[model samples]
Target: MKVKEMIKENNRLREQMTPFNRSYLEDMILVLRASRVDPLRTEELLLEAAQQMLIAQKKGNTATQVFGDDPEAYFKEVIETTPSRPARSKLNYYLMIPWTALTLLFGVMAIVGLISEWTTGSAGMFGQISLFTLLSVGLGSIIFIEMIMKWMSSLSDTDAPRVGKFNIKGFGVYIAIAVVVIYAGLYLSQLFPPFALSPWVSLILSIAGLLGLKFIFLK
Candidate 1:
């Protein structure tokens, strides 16, 4: 073939492959991101894959065909097998010490305040409720932070599955648990006259009841 014809053919092939290449790389990135893979390692793997795909395309094979039917699964498998840098280094563990200290200090203060309020009977029903709510929020935040840390740490270990990603089943379970807890709290509050069920509490119960029904029946 003439040199001019060969050059034209190469340009045509590149133009045709550009969109498919972009799509494949994008899908691979999503898989890596979902798996919590290291950013630097993710980029290196993507570049290497792109180069290999381009070479295959130059040999007249479609990149999509080479990648096969399930590109995401294929890329995920690649990421799982390839060795990468540790997700959390010793420096990261050292940095968390201050955070741990702060959390412990806050927890102790919260417990002390709750005990003082309970003994004195100074805080009104609403005030006591607010304090309990604050405690729950603090605990929930700690749990969420721990989950994120675990997920980050697991990224380097191929044997450890991805963590912290939300699933519908998990979300449903959370909602159901929250509903049950709130309902139980309201039921128990009735046993104590000081925390009598107010109109607002009744309204909350009604809403929760509706949600519980929906969760059960809709699913």
Candidate 2:
């Protein structure tokens, strides 16, 4: 066979291979379309495909001939043709659970303090004022918590359950802290009045109460 004829034959085969390479690239794009993952995630995939296309072009394969030797062009086309990404929801309200729980739990504690003062008849004007403030703050906090819980319940089922549990647990923790603090305060006050609270006995009792709470919490 003549050398010129052999070269022509080679050229024809290369042209025929182009369509087959193009079809594979088309198939890849189709497979990517079928994927359930978000389109934004496809950026990396498109980049990889572009690199492969560039390599195929350099290798002088039929695939590169149809898609072109320029991987950047294919990457740009994929990016432009990609589906619009969905907007992410900002459910930051879930973050309010712990704060809500603390407020409600502390508010109830304040109301209890007020009642205790009233029953003992030892509360002066300042004490009454403090108690009233506590009662108001606590009641307001409870109302706020109820509102938050209702709103959360109406949104996501999974998130609502988790947030609800967090609020409950936080409230329980606050109550436990309150009980420990109150008991220690009462015990120390009985042993040493405020005027004489600087005494060694009062200091020891106060430290003992704190250490006891630490032990209880650890257990």
Candidate 3:
């Protein structure tokens, strides 16, 4: 089945679970997504789990009975046993993430620049973008992913997952480091020989990039 269809089916079935079972399933969803398993594999695994839970529910077995009380332990086994994506697929996913980030970042700046130039006759958000700016976005994506996984790590023990589960102190420290990374990127860009992109050119590159992501890397 298509990933979307599997997900739709899973959702429709999971709703039949008891309140306790449903909450446990929701926690599983959070941990599964945060685990960074392959997207299609993740959905398939989820649908299977949902199907099992439904069958067990009819037999009067709670989620904890069939799937173990500790989600931490159950999913640890599942994720470990799950095969890793092929090296090439892994490379493509990583490359796609950064490329998507880069194009979207510059695309927004391009639009803002065009608007500013139209009204005030001066360059907008950025006068020039540098190679270091690309480095920053790439690093930022990695950092963002690490932060997310770190937070999700705590959800394994919780009965239900929610935003309140995030650690405030950890988030504060992460935000500080992120602030430093942003300034550091801006400063490093000043050290490089930067080139200007006319608003039209920037916009065209952004559009072309989205097309490339949509077609060539169509995975």
Best by lDDT: 3
User: Relative to the true structure, how large is the alpha-carbon lDDT of every model?
Assistant: 0.50, 0.44, 0.77
Every model: Cα RMSD to truth: 17.5, 24.5, 4.2
Error of 1 at 14 (Å): 13
For candidate 2, write residues 82-176 as lDDT tens digits: 65544321122232333344344444444554565578743333232232333334344544565554444333222122332345665565566
Q: What's the C-alpha lDDT at position 130 in model 2?
A: 34
Collision count for each candidate, in order: 0, 2, 0
Query: What is the lDDT ranking, best to worst?
Result: 3, 1, 2
Candidate 1 lDDT by residue in tens digits, 56-85: 877877556777755566676666776654
Better of 2 and 3 by TM-score: 3
TM-score of candidate 1 relative to the true fold? 0.32
Stretches of candidate 3 off by over 4 Å are: 14-23, 26-42, 55-61, 72-84, 159-187, 216-218
TM-score of each: 0.32, 0.20, 0.70
Q: What is the total number of backbone clashes in candidate 2?
A: 2
In terms of TM-score, the best-performing candidate is: 3
Model 1 segments beyond 4 Å from truth? 1-21, 51-63, 82-168, 174-219
State in Å the error of residue 208, model 2.
72
